[model samples]
Target chain A: MVHVGANPGRSGHRLSAQAARIVFDTRQGLAELFGVSDSRQIVFTSNATAGLNIALHGMLGPRDHVVTTSMEHNSVMRPLRHLARERGVRITVVAADREGRVDPAAIREALEPKTRLVAINHGSNVVGCIQPIAQIKEAIGKVPLLVDAAQTAGSYPISIERDGIDLLAFSGHKSLLGPAGTGGLYVRPELDLPPLVRGGTGSRSESDQQPDFRPDKYESGTLNTCGIAGLGAGVRFILERGVETIHNHEMNLLDVFLERLRRIEGVVLYGPSSTEARLPTVSLNVEGKSPSQVGGLLDKRHDIMVRVGLHCAPDAHRTIGTFPDGTVRFSAGALNTTDEMEQAVAAVDEIARS
Target chain B: MSSGKHVVLAFDSIHDVIKAEKIIVRHGIWCDLIPTPRELSSDCGMSIECRTDDLPDLESLRENGALEWRDIHRPE
Candidate 1:
């Protein structure tokens, strides 16, 4: 707010200095969280969707073959579909199992000789199953791997070096505890992912050409400096708390919720039964009640909050046989406690019975 | 304009010039971005101005591909 209320913009030391600090702190913080070697590789975007768009538009083009999955959100699916319609690019979608798990080997078989990129979600926002990128990377060979970490970023310990993730798009609002409209991607220094939008970057005021740099090349126009300030603080908070500890807290809550939830009569759960292979996000449907009804009852009567409906991954619902109706999403976050989990279980059990 | 023999590096684009400013400033070098003198060229872009003694350092920057310059101009 200090940055915004103070009238920050180009041609001033206050704004310029704040920009520099935002660059330093946010980069350093995200780099530390993701285990990136250099902070320069991080480029802020409006959201993970925008970052994914930049990656897709910048890397793939006509005649290039891309491999993705049926479990992708519209963010990835819509862009690829647009490219398919307009650019004549070829896309092969690897199908996930009934459990919403993609066989790592099947992904390799789907890889064509001309496959330019393999874009996958680190974890499904709808089904809540974590994709095994480490295993999938071993099969991907030299193809670039783009992991959408919107669901896993601040909640999971993801190492680009260890996981062999080539490009990672993350949302600051989700797990990083940052403001909305604040997110970014970490591009490998050797790789050049071109800019999706081009204009003045405040640096290259002379020529109309975009600057050919890591960040400025991709990040053109005036940035969300205030949101970036909040994002920087958010990342710092994650670092102080330690990602593993946060993950443990969320996982423990999941353990209790799952143990009680599976025993409830008429309660049907989707995705992995155990939380070990996914985020703390769980999806389920009660016996007789619709997703909306359950969600309404939870919110109105129990004062519980959750994301419901297709969760923006329709294909994922189809994979798990929940299309059209969707499921109630009980996602545990950084601040959610075990007490809340018990209450959530009891409420769901009550709703299932009533 | 200023009565001194200064080193002004001409760049192809504004992005290069801004990057040059950031790189130069980070290395403890004091430089100012100013409009190209009207007598110098018709490009109508900005240049990074420094002391004539900074030539070796500037040349080194150019050698390493960090800075790209179209030409070096010394106002008479």
Candidate 2:
């Protein structure tokens, strides 16, 4: 923030150009991360919810049907809900198994003649089950697939072309290790979704209408350049470290945490039984204590930080049969070590006993 | 080499201009980023200033989908 603070794309000055370069590099970095050939297909947003909102609202119309899984967060749920009530859009939420796994064939069965979009989360923020995106895409045939990668973007290996993902929304804060308020959406080159909002794009000053372009079409206002710079650096670090290496490290941490938690009495774990099919996120509840109680104790006494309750995905909690009361969710990242996981497990054990 | 002749390539956005500039430099061609001339276009952003002789290379870049230019200006 100290230097290169000029508003990007607004002027021709060196500092402004520098700021624009920062934004460009971020787009390129995200493109590289997601295996997008053209970086222009990626557009910056305030968060993943903003990106999802754009992809959903821009593409879907009245009488259009959307098929989404039960493991989706409110980011996907709320927009679909609004479209259903306001725009007369139809929604069919395919139920996932108790472990939060959605069958690919079920997605095919759920398809309708009016189905315009199939929205699903790449990973569950609450239960951590990773979806089979390619299989789901194959099942849906020609319909467009929108994957919300808010929980899996940086942590998992995702290639838009290889995975057959038409639209992907991701969060920079969760697994990308970027600052808050930095996220993006990737629009497949073949797809044309209108902008959520339109204004000055620093280009086409002569035209009052919104410029029909890749990024400038979606990104209307001034971007969070400072946040994007940090996001670019974070993506660079991930690239250097290798996403596979980071994934293995996180899974190892999850394995150790899971083993330790299983040994503790009165603790019931949720999500996939194995670590191979899930992220490092884990949800559990003590036999008798409420999630809030255990979460509060973990914070106050043990100084261990973990999110508690619905996590904004009541449907996910409902899928795992932890709705209303919710679960104590623990999410580990690349920086977390096995030692820290052990400490967290010990804290959970104590909380379980209490 | 002092050839007074120059070709101006204006793009729809600064992103394309910067991308084209990088590609031109990578191809070992000479180019300068200057403010888009008002006569060429109303875009207040930047544009590419290159030698007229490098038009062939810019054409090849555009043909390969590597560059996108809205308009070209050549001195009479």
Candidate 3:
């Protein structure tokens, strides 16, 4: 495909009219994907981190208290920590099980009357363990729920309204297959969030004051129009492929990889042993081998791309007993193939033997 | 595809197409946006096509800062 701008905001005169239509249709498609109403509830951001910041800053104040889990990416954890340290907002981090899963009952026990928000990651980026968000939401009662869906948005089915999620943050690049610098937050229409950024949205040009709306309220300055434009294309691609098929393919690959990893004598896997309860992302360390060493061998020797280190989630690493040194991460996508997984398994087996 | 008429629109940027789409849809018009057809000029790679009768809606779109308007079937 030619590299066309997916950006509806900056297509200018050539596509001045149609660009807007594309974005509208794209939002409708996304709303259907998430089983939500009114595309207006979705606000575009530069990335998932930006969406998290918007949700965190918009919903909570100095006197509020927040509840989160240890398996969060820095996008969620760092902002909450900052809020606690600087603004005097109170936060409680519920610990996760060794498999990196947060028990919903633990979260319920951590809640207080002053709790304003409950933030949780839908899936652990390090171990790929999926959280029990529905149960957590049930336990939260009236408190608002924010789900960090960076690793699970397109890879799995997420229904914001049906699941009782007040806010959701996702990245376009990871599984949505769009360019970087594109992501969004889905805020339920009822919650009134403060504007995170203030400037031109081209909608309220007549007034000096910024428009108090879902997207325009948060979206300030010129948007990453080109990135979002590509995101439209990426979203269309995923919709056409069907989310269920994609999930099945990923789980099948994970199944094969996990079975092979288990057969290897010295390899130690993290997270749930079964593919049924986790994403396709697998983290593991071979006996007598550092994660970086195995990662380098996989890349230099086998020409395979994998992520190593804390995966920007130190708490998740700590929860799974892989902290400090981290572990090799293999995140499968819709485009990943079974043969590739076999090759990856073979490479790991050889490395473990060495 | 012949049952429905298609109109090709060119945009200088992606933002314009996105904005224009929202305006037209609110008026109950349906349109499809695709990578700018290759037979058309290659300046940009996205276009919109919808029923030809929606031309008046096009004027409203232009009033809202939409700049380019072209009939896809116009003879080259």
Candidate 4:
């Protein structure tokens, strides 16, 4: 299907004005999905990494303190590290539980008067544990909360306004089923943020100076229009399918995988065992087998796709006692089926036994 | 399809359209990348069409960042 929003700024002529309205409607739909008041609050980016960078660099400066969890993807961790190294920002990493879950009290204890931003990953990429963001926001009191929702956005229901999230970064490619390089940020209207990239926004093309706006300020150069359109299609697909149904489907798969893996001897699973407190992703290590070995075997022998290694969250792996070596990650999605999970379980059983 | 009269252009970056036109003319594909018209809703600002049969190779172009595809027909 032809994607929506593929010709955003350039669409003044090609499509009838009514077709263009679909783009606006898609943005509005996104706003409603995230529980934001205005669609203007949503700014599109090339990817979630860019959105995270924008949120980190735009809102932080020298001597500003930020609190984050150990389970963050590199999208959040790398930027904070850069800020600390170059801009003199202080960052405190709140430790997670043995199951890779971050406790709100731990985040509260890490906070200080200088803490300007409290950033956390909604769902861990390595262990699939879901952080208690509402509790963390409550503990933060007044600090602006920035959530990296790269793995959770379309897969789970989110309400940025209701949850007190000041900024949210999400990826369109993963759970959203959009094309890669499509992501966005939801910034609260009241926050004062510096522009990450400044250039022409098509609205005021004649003016050399950048427009002082939420999206135009952050979005520099031309956008990935086709990717955004695909993202819109993906989002609409998810909205129609229902986030709760997607969540249930993934959770059911997770339950089956966990139960099957737990029954096997010498197989170790990380993160919460219960489906209620986690995403559908599961990370596990088979005794006497490295993650790379298992991942290779699964792909080469079984034609199954799985991610292995640090999964870009070293601290999370460390929290779950899988650091350095990492674990094999099987991330279930709306497209995944019970048969696939069974096939994966059988593959794991074979690999573990051999 | 006209005999050797068509051209195909694939682009990863919109900026690559300039390069694609030069290469197409050099190889004699008789095609060029133009700013996407209103009828074609593609992500990038440019599209290429030399022949309808070139559509089968669209996935190859996608690997280079051509997120959308369109066919251009020159009015005889």
Candidate 5:
């Protein structure tokens, strides 16, 4: 940030060019991380919600039907609801199993002749169940698939091409290890979705109209070059260590944590039983204790913090029968050690017992 | 003034200009990212300046799909 604080692509000066280089490197780095062939296909956004908004609002029109699931966060739900109210768009929400697993056949059955897009949450933020994205692609033939990878971008293995994902929205802060306000959307090169915002891209200065291009089409105004620089370094760190290695490490921690929690008398766990089918996030509740109460105790007494309540996905909370009140989610990261997992589990056990 | 000694390549996007600059420099050719010359039509604000001696190399890079440019100009 100190090095490249200048506005990228705004001028032909050395500092501007340096800032542009940082943005370009970050773009290339993200493309590499997501297994995208063309880096230009991805455009920076403020966060995953913004990316999802672009994909949702830009592509869907009045009377267009979209197929989604109950496992989606408000990032997908709120936008679709707005589209339905404002543009008269139709939506079909496929229900996931109690474990937050969406069936591919259910998704295929939801598709209509006028279905314009199929949007799925790649991983449920509430339950941590990883959706069967590639299999869903085979089910819904030519309809474009938009995968919201907000919770799984760097934590899970995702290849846009190999998975047949038409669009991907990811958050850099969660698993990509970048700072907040850094995220992006990847549009398949063949799909020409219109820009959500347009003004100055530092290109086509002679023309008053917005330029028709890969990135500049979606990316308008000055970008968060400083955040992108950090994102680049974060993605670089992930690439150097390898995603599979990180995933395996987190899974190991999760295994230890879940095993200990399962042995507790009053604790009830949510999501898949196997580690392979989920991210490192675990949701649970203790008998006779509200989620917030447990969360507060864990914070003030044990010095261990966890997210409690609905987690912004009311439908997911409803699916798991934890609605109105929610579950206390213990999210494990790559840096979390097995010893830390044991300590956390011990803390939870103590809380449940009391 | 038409400077026959140097060639300026204009591109459609800053991405292409930066990419072409990297490929050109990596090929042992000297180039600088300059503002697009007034005489050339370009969609981007930046262009690359290189010696005329490297023109053949730039052409080869384009043929090999390493570089893409909208116009070539020699400004006086």
Candidate 6:
């Protein structure tokens, strides 16, 4: 609010020079986090959904073929589904295994000559399994890869160039620790996708036609300058602390939490075993109780916060064979203490015994 | 002698000039956000100025994609 208040343009009409600097800094910081050279490749959006939409809408058209995965959240899936129905875009969904793992070979096999893009997620929200994106890139030679990094951006390390990702979309609120309604998409410099919106950019004001450039090409109208300032702060915090350090800390805590919880009888843990490099998210069910019931018990009785239900990834739940009744999701953030893990594990164990 | 040979960094907008200042300063060089000299640039209202001695550091920052500078000048 202060950023917007200090700046004249709330909806992007007349922005004070200060807010623009923060926006650029925010993009540059994110680029550094992604291990990319140019921050100009980073474009802001309302959220990852909007970012994904910008990529899809800009890249996909009638009869354009796209290859995606079953483990995708509705953000990617729904957009593709709509494109298929409304725009005649053909889609091939690579099936995930019972463990919610997609075989890169399957994705490679699904690709056809007409395929315009290949979309996949870096991590699964439900199963918490990390995908080998680089291997998948190797499988699909030169097929532009669009990654949904919503679950993995801040919690893990991603290198756009190293990973061979063409376009990457990520949410700011989840792992970036920024305010909601803030996120961005990174498009490789050589690649140009159509703008999501075309409006005032304070550039080429002489002509009504929107300027075709990097940030101006994609970002039209006023942006969430305040949120972006906050997002820049969030990225700086990650940078100063180190992404790998935070990731390692979260994984270690998850290890301790899983070690304690999975051993309890009647506790049904979902997703990959502790052997895999996964997010700190753990989903489980108490044998005789509902997920919501167990979640409530953890919250009310143990003062633990967790997300329960489908987690906006129905296909992921179905892949794990939990359809209507979802698992209780316990996500350990960067700040979670070892004691909190123990208390959460003890809470689940007590609930399981009851 | 090199102090007179300064780099001129211009942008498309004042906000971008401000962004350039932040990026340059963060990289450890002191840059003055001055009014864009008409002779140096027709880009934005503001530009960044740094001593020519910092050229290598500026080059490294540019290589790292610190900011996309429009033009640079060295006056005799």
Each model's iRMS: 6.6, 1.6, 10.2, 12.0, 1.3, 6.4
> For model 2, what is the error of residue A111's alpha carbon versus the real structure, in angstroms, after optimal superposition?
0.7
Model 1, global lDDT? 0.81
Docking class of 5: medium
Instruction: Estimate, for each residue in A233-325, the C-alpha lDDT of model 3 and write its tens digit.
Output: 888888999888899989999988898889999999999888766799999999998999999999999998899999999999999998899
Candidate 5 lDDT, tens digit per residue, A237-282? 9999999999999999988998889999999999998897789999
- What local lDDT score does residue A171 receive in model 2, on the 0 to 100 scale? 87
The candidate 6 chain A region of ten consecutive residues with least summed lDDT is A6-15
Span of 10 residues, lowest total lDDT, candidate 2 chain A: A8-17
What lDDT score goes with residue A293 in model 4?
98
DockQ of each: 0.12, 0.57, 0.11, 0.03, 0.63, 0.18
* Candidate 3, residue A167: how far the Cα is off, in Å: 0.3
The A-chain TM-scores of all the candidates are 0.96, 0.99, 0.96, 0.95, 0.99, 0.95
Local lDDT at A37 for model 5: 87
Using Cα atoms with residue i matched to residue i, what is each candidate's TM-score against the true structure? 0.84, 0.96, 0.82, 0.80, 0.98, 0.86
Look at candidate 6 and give me any clashing residue pairs: A11-A222, A12-A222
Ten contiguous residues with the weakest lDDT in model 6 chain B: B37-46
> Runs in model 3 with CA error above 4 Å?
A1-14, B1-76
* Candidate number with the higher DockQ (4 or 6): 6
Using lDDT as the measure, the top candidate is 5
Model 2 scores a TM of: 0.96
DockQ of 6: 0.18
When 1 and 5 are scored with lDDT, the better candidate is 5
True contacts kept of 1: 0.02
> In model 5, what is the error at residue B67, expressed in angstroms?
1.6
TM-score values for chain B across all models:
0.79, 0.84, 0.66, 0.41, 0.86, 0.79
